[model samples]
Target: METNRNSNIIKLKQNLKYRNILIDAFPLLGLIIIILFFTIITSGNLLTLNNLKIILNQMFLYLIGGLGSVYLYAQGGIDVSMASNIGFSAILGVRIMYQHVGIGIIATLLIGSSIGLLMGIIYAYAGIPVFIQGLAMDFLLKGTLYPLSGFKASIPVPDRLLKFDNKYFAWIFLLIIFIFIFFTYNFSRFGKECRSIGAGEIASIQSGIKVKKNKVLAFFISGLTCGIVAVYTLIRTGSASQSTGLGFNFNVMLSLVLGGCVLGGGNGVKVRNAVIGAVTFVVLQNGLVLCGASARAQDIVKGILFVLMIVFTSKMYERKV
Candidate 1:
């Protein structure tokens, strides 16, 4: 019966392989399920063209911020200062453009990203820890927002600023931006080096990966994404507030984790995963709001779902038997 037992083992392994493929694809499946449920729950309310625009708008905003975050992921680190970065930069960029020569939108992005590049340099080369680096950036940026605004919450943002957030503009802009970055990162030597660094820094360095440069570039892009995302945020709300980026740290981190990037780093590092994860959270929140759930209840549910995602994505539970 030894030969029969061997045949059975082979079959079992094949079955298990298919099972994993499904499990791995579950997040995308879950996204579809949520959309269907959303269609049924809100019926006409959420099924309208305007509603769809709104969803796209939110997605546009979050994904831009999360894009920088994906860079951090690809580089084996994290940037928790997203909300603060966006808010402060929005306030700062607007004021600078309005008061002086109007560096315009593109220039504003450069400034925000420069700040991020500086932060990354400090972290990667100065030997500062990533966690501390993130926390410090968040605080420093947050503190800068109020003073930069001259303690004003209602900065008169130029109407010209609205162009970036316009639906068509965001659609075209985000599409080109992400696709370009995605391919550039996945296909280039720099991209390869970033993932290598994430996989194992010491090993990557030994292999001549230029770890610090890649990390700095990644952080700079992330900062630029923050600025890009902020453009949308300003459009949606029409004004930047002290609380504009109040809870971004938690939201961005949640999106990253849900996307299947491990806590410490090192994975296949896909930006598509980040997009999918952000969509999951957005759908969850939208569903809760439609169901008339309280904010507190929604928060609790989100926490529970995140935990579930962690469990599902965990490798610790692999069964050998």
Candidate 2:
């Protein structure tokens, strides 16, 4: 009887080991499947050099946004105001660029970080939920856009700023930001603290973690990235409008989830998730257009995929817990 019981326990352990391996490999596997499906549907047009370049270029904003949001997501928080903040920042920054390019850049970044810090302050002190604060902030920012744009439909960025709108600059900037986030998210005390909070806020507090400070800092990081992405978006498009950055926050969430981030957040949250997710998202979007999928159809597909990912990740999280 004792021998039989031991064997059963051993078998269960082996099964769990295999399950964990499968979970870890799911994101890469999903990415492969997406690529293959799209390629087939587009009759290989999705893999063309020009199409690939467009996808890569479009991916930068999502990648940066994902990287920044990873910090907030790590603590089971999110900033839905990111899109609005980017638009608002771009408007102010573009106006300033007309006067002084360097100062304009500085001002844009400050605006982004300041908004994030303000959210953190409200969350930390006033005890407002992150989602609630983010929505409130989003509306506030959007409402001010018209006034900022002088009631115009769009505002062009200064011509001098267009020089930064190339593949080379994007690649270089992405690499720098990726390295910074990689180090801080994977190796630093702050990363550990954030994950711990996500894992269990009560436990984190008891363990001497400064939960509030870390939470605020994470929001600041997110906001700062919004500023950087704002500038990139402005330079690439050469203009800012009320429609700028619309649905971006949702896309970031989708990318992160697609990359294998559990909405609950915890030790399982990997930095590479953002990179993988960003690539997957861009490819998916580009491929749909190449396949002649209608805009409405694309939205339906995306909505379905997003829901499926959320459900799957949530189940996986429950199993781990």
Candidate 3:
């Protein structure tokens, strides 16, 4: 009886491991399926070189933001203020640019890092929930943004820097960022520490992980990324508006989720996940438009897909008894 019980337990563990492997592959599988489906439905227009360029352009910022966010999500923290942070950072960068041509870029990055560091301090040391801190920050920035811009519909980019808008520049910049993040995330101590924290904070603390420091670092990285993307957004649109970073928080979250990165973190985080998800998301949106899906219909489809993916991911990563 004892031997039989042990054998059955081993088999159960194997089955669970196999199931997890399949779940892990789902995002990539889904990406392929979605692309093929859209390609067929759009009658091959989706695969054209020009359309592919459009998809790459659309996904560039999302991929950058998503990469930065992997650190936060790995530690099981969420920041709803990132979108507002990006918007406010861009505004500050623009103001500085107006005073001195090149200094504005550095100023914007610094402001973003500062805000992220502040939030991380509050969340890690002050005992505030990261989410609440994010909400408060968002509101504060949005309130100040209106008065600072004098309620302008948008702030136009400096004509001299307009050349940055070219896709070639964008791709090179994105590639550099991606390479840096990929190395840091896969090989650095920071990645391991974050995964440990996400797996369980109490356990991480007991293991001498310096949870507070790592948490702050994660937030700072996230902020830095937001700031960089703010520059990208400003260049891409050649302007910054009240709506400049609107919906970014949602879009990044969605991209991460779609890429199979769990909200609770720890188990299945990868830099490639963000890239895959970002590309998949852009393709999905562009395909829908080509197929003439109305805005309402698109939202419905997206909502349903989001729910299904969440359910699938959650189940895949659940702890077994």
Cα RMSD (Å) per model? 3.1, 1.8, 2.3
TM-score attained by model 3: 0.93
Candidate 2: list runs displaced more than 4 Å: 1-14
How many residue pairs of model 2 clash at the backbone? 0
TM-score of 1: 0.87
Ranking of predictions according to lDDT? 2, 3, 1
Error of 1 at 196 (Å): 2.1
**Best by the lDDT measure:** 2
Better of 1 and 3 by lDDT: 3
Best by TM-score: 2
What is the C-alpha lDDT profile of model 1 across 152-196, one tens digit per residue? 866766776655455776678778877987887778787778777
lDDT of 2: 0.88
What is candidate 2's lDDT per residue for 44-120, written digit by digit as tens?
A: 88889998888888898899999988888999898999999999999989899999988999999999999999888
lDDT of 2 at 143: 99
Off by over 4 Å in 1: 1-20, 43-46, 99-102, 163-165, 316-321
Q: Report the lDDT tens digits of candidate 3 across residue range 88-138.
A: 999888888788757988888988888999889889999888888899999
Q: Which ten-residue region of model 3 has the weakest summed lDDT?
A: 312-321
TM-score for each candidate, following the candidate numbering: 0.87, 0.94, 0.93
